[model samples]
Target: MGQQQDDEDREFDIKWADGAEHKEPSARARMLAARWKENPPGPVPFRGEPEGVGPRWSSWVSTAVVLGSVVAVIVLLGYVNFRAPY
Candidate 1:
């Protein structure tokens, strides 16, 4: 029984050596390559805003807030400079 088990284990053992000959791609690989050749994949579709969907109102509100802050800073600076006693 032990000798039989040893033989079975030896059957599965793979022997590796340098300069091994290269093998052709398997059947599944060849089939996939042919399919790809027939209908080559294109660039991944752009996942931009969905159709019929417009920009969110929050985006507009944020833009307005940023612009308003910039204008307010400019106006405050002008007022302060004009009031400075030179």
Candidate 2:
């Protein structure tokens, strides 16, 4: 049996050499970290739940509202400036 080396082991300062020097993690630490590399804690875990509309839908709705308001204002302004023939 032999210890495996991990590739994604990031740089980290750990006590070493009688606590005199601080530098990158040793091969042992890197190897240990690699074991959990596949499942690191960071990204939001998907809690079992039915998915629904996300941020994309929210942005689209807001944009549509703003565009509608602008168009309405422009039409009202033009109507006021040029009234229908009496």
Candidate 3:
């Protein structure tokens, strides 16, 4: 089991050419970056202060949806009548 585990943990060998050269960015990539610098996209806000009770309103909506679902289920079960036959 130890030998099998060692073999599983072993990494495969890779051979790289000695004459390989790193290529610079193309003209199109440079142009796009320059244009973005001139006029960037709008910022995306992940977390910020709610505007005029916005956060509280959304929380109330979520709570209402959950409670409404529970009440609906209870009403549905009340309408269901089951009988046992022997």
Report lDDT (Cα) of residue 69, candidate 2. Answer: 100
Per-residue lDDT of model 3, residues 1-86, tens digit only: 99877765552211223234765578998898899999986786888677785545678899999999999998787666333333
- Candidate 3, residue 59: the lDDT equals 85
What is each predicted model's overall lDDT from 0 to 1?
0.83, 0.69, 0.71
Which digits, one per residue and each the tens of the lDDT, describe model 2 over residues 2-68?
A: 2222322221222233466555788998987997698676666676434784535578899999999
Query: Local error of candidate 3 at 49, Å?
Result: 18
Task: Give me the runs in candidate 3 sitting further than 4 Å from their true place.
Answer: 1-22, 45-60, 79-86
lDDT of 1 by residue, 4-76 (tens): 9988777655332223477578899999899999998877767867889987779889999999999999999
Model 1 stretches astray by more than 4 angstroms: 1-57
Positional deviation of residue 24's Cα in model 1 after best superposition, in angstroms = 24
RMSD, candidate 2, Å? 14.4
